[model samples]
Target: MSAKTKYTDEPIGPVKVIPDFLPPPEELVFKEDTVKVTIALSRESVEFFKREARKHDTQYQKMIRRLLDAYAVAHSKAKQNEITAKRPARRR
Candidate 1:
């Protein structure tokens, strides 16, 4: 049997009060506008995602979705920049 911890009344020196760094309950839950689509993918791509998802301990479909979302966001930003760069400067 293990020995019980002894009770002590000694004050802990230099206690620091830490602020709450956690997000609120509403923010904690992520809600995204998603739509279901039926599409076919190459066997090799699906297999690759599945293998990676197994190694990372996450769902394969989720990994694929995140990858597509990131790709879309990156391309959207790039397209916006391209358009802005192509525009002529306005004269005062």
Candidate 2:
């Protein structure tokens, strides 16, 4: 940053309208149903997630939960595709 930078107080041109590229407010409010359960994790795994979560400024538990959710979604899609491919085609 320079101390001698020039700045102007002139009025700007008319604002251009841009299309909104965001989901609706109602649609954005997603409430995830969660269950509390006790489980044991390895020391190394816990440490790894904790470090990464600290770097990202988020809770370690949330990071772990999102990771598991992504993995489940990937496997679920693969299983669905495999089943679809194995099914015989219908005749008209």
Candidate 3:
């Protein structure tokens, strides 16, 4: 007598199984204290961003975020000074 196989011999086209429909798997974790930002730019700038992103192996939006964050931190005082100096003098 021959032993029967437990698995099927037919080929499956594609698997549509979702492992974690209700929650993330053990290897995946969620961050709760993250901030989300949205920026709008021209198509040309977006292409430039994508190129830079590829060079750094990062997403374009992440590159923009890093740049904006650094600029805000480094130039906040200078920006404030410029805005204050631009205000017109009030007449007596």
Model 3, range 1-92, lDDT digits (tens) per residue? 99986898789788897543232355236433548767668999999999999998989986776567556755786788899999999899
Name the candidate that leads on TM-score: 2
Predicted structure with the largest lDDT when compared to the true one: 1
Better of 1 and 3 by lDDT: 1
Off by over 4 Å in 1: 1-29
What is the total number of backbone clashes in candidate 1? 0
**Candidate 1's TM-score:** 0.64
Q: Worst 10-residue stretch by lDDT in candidate 1?
A: 19-28
Clashing pairs in 1: none
Give all TM-scores, in the order shown: 0.64, 0.68, 0.44
Q: Rank the candidates by lDDT, best first.
A: 1, 2, 3
Model 2 pairs whose backbones collide: none
lDDT of 1 at 33: 80
User: What C-alpha lDDT values do all the predictions have?
Assistant: 0.85, 0.83, 0.73
Instruction: Tell me the tens digit of each residue's lDDT in model 2 across 1-92.
Output: 76897789987889999754444579548977888878899999999999999999999998887778767867797899999999999899
Which pairs, if any, clash in model 3? none
